[model samples]
Target: MVDLDPEYVAARGVLLDALEALADHREAIVLVGAQAVYLQTVPLPGYQPYTTDADLAINPSLLGPRPGLEEAMRRAGFRLKDEDTGHPEPGIWEARIRVAQRRDDLVVPVDLIVPEAVAPPGGRRGARLAGEHGRRAARRATGLEGALVDHSLIEVGALDEGDSRRTTVNVAGLAALLVAKLHKIGDRADRPDRLTDKDAGDVLRLFMSATSQDMTQRLIDLLEDARSAGATRAAIDRLDPLFGTPRSLGTQMAVRALAGVLDPATVQATCRTFAAQVLAALGGAG
Candidate 1:
């Protein structure tokens, strides 16, 4: 595993705690967000800038009608974050845990999201969960429709040196991850200031996952079997204008994000080249 900061290690510890808390519903859980990408990228988690939150996309359909995810989480000491802080984000929940090397209980947030398909239509923008107790356990997330099917089961271990917790979880694969990242990126592309260097850097790290050639070939196979090809196709459509050249805004943002650990020019050149191979594997459709 990549060495993580003590804070991130605590985040992982909390994540493991949450996952284990929902152990009965593990198969129904699809790990998304940076942690999902981190799981697939393994030995190289990110562009040397580790992500902080653990995001999970749960399939309510697979979870039985009885006890729901919210109930399980609450049973494990998780509470609605907004309720505690008087904020309005109902989908966010947190738990306090005492870990070694930390003087106090760390409050780590676990973001619960679900495929938009499962969310009730007309969109108040939350999951169709009664939580078996009528609670807004998760929020509706776009581009996660394919994730319930486009993922791989992996054994995940805590990054904390003091935490020995481990469990098997389904993590979103490369194409699904790219699609999710692009979904978030595409939203902010028009407003470059809103585009986070973190998201751009994530795209580059994915491109940096395996050899460009190998990653492209694997991506092709993934797209072929993907449930919602449109999502990945839309992701591909965003790439050329975004990372088709070394100077593209997306590539530049990635360079900026990784500037802390890598040479800027090299990262820019590499992203452009990898972006080309990826697009080519899609028959240069965009």
Candidate 2:
């Protein structure tokens, strides 16, 4: 494993406190997004960084009409930003936080994304694919809440998915999730403001590294389906550049040569371009 940056460690403490509060009502928190990436217990391919945010999928039902979550966060030295969209009722509810302190102008960003869907039946809250690491992390967070916090209303481990088929099935289901999320962008265009450049960059890098030809082909087929279904060309175009024609095994290896010469800035730029292509293809399909 690669060494983690010190900044990641500092920001993690703040995020842990925040997650501990959410875990107070463990069953109500559905873990998803990048936060789940760290819980996967494996480093994301080559990227070497500690995650600093907690992402959850709340049933939306569990969140009261007035947003009281902000108070819980405030106790931990985290102030809810007025711009947060997750909970806008009372003080503030944020899915993203920037550390108040900075070292060398680096302010760590912790993101807590809430997806529209809750866990399917028998799925663990906030984590479906997370194996041992996720369980361990969740337990640690729960313990912290119990020992240090007074969250009487919160419940921990309300649901367990020891036998959840959705999780135990295999890689096929995991691949399908990528496909599903690829398709999901269309349904989300109504909120044009929701699309961020950083989000596009992450998707591009993930798609570039995490997928195989078989998966890419499946994605292409889906894009074609979306286009036939009347998706927009502009939307499809944004997501198209992230990909090229399917690669041969040898070509895939050859591409790594560029990684040596390409700087981080270049890699990010390339990923962004590729992600735009992916978005475009998805849009055209819809």
Per-candidate TM equals 0.85, 0.41
True-vs-predicted CA distance for residue 223, candidate 2, Å: 14
Each candidate: RMSD: 3.2, 13.7
Candidate 2 per-residue C-alpha lDDT over 27-72 given as tens digits, one digit per residue, 9 for 90 to 100: 4444433333233323444555444443333333344433234444
User: Each candidate: what lDDT?
Assistant: 0.74, 0.35
Residue-level lDDT for 129 in candidate 1: 71
Residue pairs clashing in model 1 are: 130-134
Candidate 2 — number of clashing residue pairs?
28
Where does model 2 exceed 4 Å of error?
41-46, 50-54, 62-67, 82-286
Residue 271, candidate 2: Cα error in Å is 10
Error of 2 at 139 (Å): 26
